[model samples]
Target: MTDKLPGLHMRIPPQPITERSTPRPVQRPENAGAAFQEILKSKLETSTLKFSGHAQARLRLRNIQLDAEQLDKLEEAVDKAAAKGSRDTLVVMDGNAFVVSVRNRTVITVVDRASAKENVFTQIDSAVLTD
Candidate 1:
């Protein structure tokens, strides 16, 4: 300690700037939907992380029933296209898919309907888009 002025004193600490190396990790709420959207966007831009999943019966069945028949306000994309004199415009797609839902105003986790990789592909592939 050294006296600099009449009522002031200074003390030197023993730490140097170069010695500090590690950085603190940041924590954030897990937004699965946002994450998935980002992933899809990236996948669309770049052909990366492409893999097939096994079919799950429930997911397949759900796909078939999801927009199979839209009675009024809701219009089935595939069905509508097919009915509206669409030949090449009508796209039929069948792919196994994994359904995941996350609960949270600030998402923390994703609840997956398809447990495994194979199941995802299978379910999505089994889901008939048009035929």
Candidate 2:
């Protein structure tokens, strides 16, 4: 007795493997390292802190303005927080408080001194006080 399932029999022919007649030589740019360095430098130079929509709104609502120097200091604070492996950080510069996400290099929110005094900050792993 032969046991077989009731189904159509489908068969496919096997393909033959073909070898290339001539092996292709690997090509590399002569100034690859220098090109990569240029790219890295440009990226580092252009990199800056980003503000979330909520943070922007808060800044506008509070009439808060950040000058070039203050923004630079805030970026430095975020870098320090990142070095310390902080995910969320509270950064206080001048009289303003900023909640930053170190990994994202973004300002999550902003609070003035008056509002900061009444609010309790949460979900932050570190705090940076910068001048």
Candidate 3:
């Protein structure tokens, strides 16, 4: 003898899932580029010059010292180089030589009196002899 059981449903149909749409690119204002350029120019005009890390290290290694007067002269020399549109410049003051990047306003290297005497400077477009 066989026993009969109630009907049970086991198989179900698979359902499809919806996907999200791709995002569009953001749009900028028409004058955005001009405005950004103006802001950059203003910031550059107000920023003070600086010395690069390598320059500082060279100064320390050579035991070179710069008095207040010498500092002022170096600033003036950088300004002069910038006025001439020089990107790389050599600034000479009181037997010391400094390699400056005018656009970035940074002193890239230092040559003490002894090194300056024998070294031939290159890769610089202009030279400034500071008082």
Candidate 4:
């Protein structure tokens, strides 16, 4: 005879794993740098010069070490940018939310907002993402 249980089912639904929630797109390690460089070059060439047919602005990402959580955000941003076919993509790590530049590989336009100091991170474009 089978024992009776009020709320027991033969099968149980699987719970989502917290670790697997992070976005990790399959990328070839060798292709990452090349893709990033190509994107950067295209952006520089197509964008109109601010004055005298010359561009005087260049964005640079600061070197800051990132933890697991921050790294996840970066992965998400890079994934979105790559998927969008953006030749000039910008990956913004603002607080918890991540912002991406379509295809540009530069950290442009930083306001230094007081609220943006949620976390210190090493900002990396796709060039650094794959590696």
Q: What does the lDDT read for residue 71 in candidate 3?
A: 81
Q: Which stretches of candidate 4 lie over 4 Å from their true place?
A: 1-64, 95-131
**Model 1 agreement with the true structure over 32-120: per-residue lDDT tens digits:** 77999789655433322111233234434444333433211112332233334332221233332222111101111112334333432
Task: Report the C-alpha lDDT of model 2 over 67-120, residue by residue, as the tens digit.
Answer: 998998998888778768899999999999999988778899999988888799
The regions of model 3 sitting more than 4 angstroms off are 1-46
Off by over 4 Å in 1: 1-3, 20-35, 38-131
Stretch of 10 with least lDDT, candidate 3: 2-11
Q: Per-residue lDDT tens digits of candidate 4, residues 1-131?
A: 88889898777889887765778988778889999988976665454312111111212233234567765555555555665565444344642223234344333333223534664443433322222
Q: Let me know the TM-score candidate 2 reaches against the reference structure.
A: 0.66
lDDT of each: 0.32, 0.89, 0.86, 0.45
- How would you encode candidate 3's per-residue C-alpha lDDT over 24-127 as one tens digit per residue? 98999999999997897677566666889999999999999888878878878887787678899999998899998888888999999888776998999999
Judge candidate 3 at residue 70 and give its lDDT: 85
Angstrom error of the Cα, residue 88, model 2: value is: 0.7
- Please give the TM-score that candidate 3 achieves against the real structure: 0.64
State which candidate has the highest lDDT.
2
lDDT score of residue 127 within candidate 3? 98
User: Which ranges in model 2 have alpha carbons more than 4 Å from their true place?
Assistant: 1-46
Scored by TM-score, the top model is: 2
